[model samples]
Target: MTTDHIGDVTKAFIDYVDHNALHAVAPENVLIEAFLNATAAEAAEVLAHLEDDDIERHLPRVIVHLIRRLAAAHKNPTPDAVAYEAQNPNLGIANQPSHLRIVKYITDVYTSQIKGDLWSVAERVAADAYTRRVGEDCERLAQIALTNVTAAELEHHIKTNVERWRDHGKRLRRITNHDNAPTNLKAVA
Candidate 1:
């Protein structure tokens, strides 16, 4: 896909994340700027090489990692700054316990909805549900610009996921019914 398309998709994914209530520790705008700044044509090319199955299986991890990095950036302005300083040891080693807890929470919530074999339609449905919720929350955050939240970050997250699903096309639709099916009629007795 072209860079413009990729950017559009990224935006949609971020919007989806904001629509959902899932909280990211990082400021939304900063996170989004970071993602946009880090991602390039090469990143999209790398994503393109991924099979649908792989994308489906690993998207959650990608999202979690992205959120973690964003959160870290928020807590630690400098590269050497420690994240979650409250957990830092006397020796100055930052305690990873809080980070781990947050990561675990994100994984738990994401996987709970997207669990099961990739081939299963239920898994796709679950993944859609998960993404949809995230999008909704992101949108909400964007609208309100809640304290400690950044609209841009939430928008970026939603855009990314939306793009992924759009790229998968048939694979995603196969697991979903976007249009309402026609109802069957009963014969008059």
Candidate 2:
């Protein structure tokens, strides 16, 4: 996964590769002189290992990898740091939200076709796992970010509903795990 040019870490390059893959264009033609600042020969050499079909089949995953590299570069600026981060597919906090968005895009634009095809079981599984991992991370991140917010909302709910609870002793007791007025009222106090 060595990048031939630092431009490989750019969003523009990722988008170009994605678009070309979707349109069934050869990767060799991806870096033509007028495009993305690379010569056609350079692009061909960089992508020599990739057949057009390979690009189409693996483009989503490749995009994710490039994004990871881009994020790493943005954060650390060192090639070693970027390469190390790219090797790990797990999302990091600095770029989690954006990465999640890209993963969603990949699933919508690429995985649907791969999963729908009966011959792509392995690819479907990989895509499903990647999306599932991203989802789990996002859920955990949201919970961490929302803990105080939820508690504040709950406190507001209790304040607004205190009178109704007092009117219905049974409900208040049920909620507070107590039969006495003092214990039940302690919640709002």
Candidate 3:
């Protein structure tokens, strides 16, 4: 809620803290550092509010108190509250057309060598492209960073296919999340 002075306002700042919690160090030096940068009086004001009981509750209280002090220090971000997008389009737009060209060219090459089913043709094209992209070190770990993930390709194949089972969402939709997940079983023998 907005107030004339920040010290009069109340808010739950758990969202920011929770989002960054996985990467944050215990006692939250990252958050403390942000608080310290605001001012000494602000630091004392915030650190005084940190609850030291159950850490699940305590850490978030500390984070919220720290964030409030930091917010009070600055001019508000987006004081005008207008949204904006990037002025320039990214190179990925250019890259997508080139990707389609590569797929078309490779598919043609494989088709000429032997007439086959569309599925086999696509698989061969992908394998050929992979081999051509990485000559010798196909399975090497260091090369994986340079490799492109075919995130769309498999989904595209399943979506466009004639088989009813191809729609994995409908075929495999869970009644309850992870209720169907397999657990490790040890033999009693």
Which TM-score value belongs to model 1? Answer: 0.20
Candidate 1 per-residue C-alpha lDDT over 69-155 given as tens digits, one digit per residue, 9 for 90 to 100: 444345322222222332333422222345555445444343333322212323233355456645665686566555565778767
Can you rank all candidates by lDDT, best first? 1, 2, 3
Residues 6-83 of candidate 3: C-alpha lDDT, one tens digit per residue: 533323355555544533432332333333233444444333333222122333333333234334454221211101
Off by more than 4 A, model 1: 1-98, 106-115, 121-168, 173-189
Clashes of 3: 0
Evaluate residue 47 in candidate 3 and report its C-alpha lDDT on the 0 to 100 scale.
Answer: 32
Order the candidate numbers by TM-score, best to worst: 1, 2, 3
Pairs with backbone N, CA or C atoms under 3 Å apart (clashes), candidate 2: none
What's model 3's lDDT at 10?
Answer: 26
TM-score winner: 1
Best candidate, lDDT? 1
lDDT of 1: 0.40
Q: Kindly state the number of residue pairs that clash in model 2.
A: 0
Across 118-161, the per-residue lDDT of candidate 2 in tens digits comes to 11222223333344444554565556556666766656655545
Q: Show model 2 residue runs off by greater than 4 Å.
A: 1-18, 22-119, 122-130, 133-138, 141-146, 149-189
TM-score of 3: 0.16
Global CA lDDT of candidate 3, please? 0.32
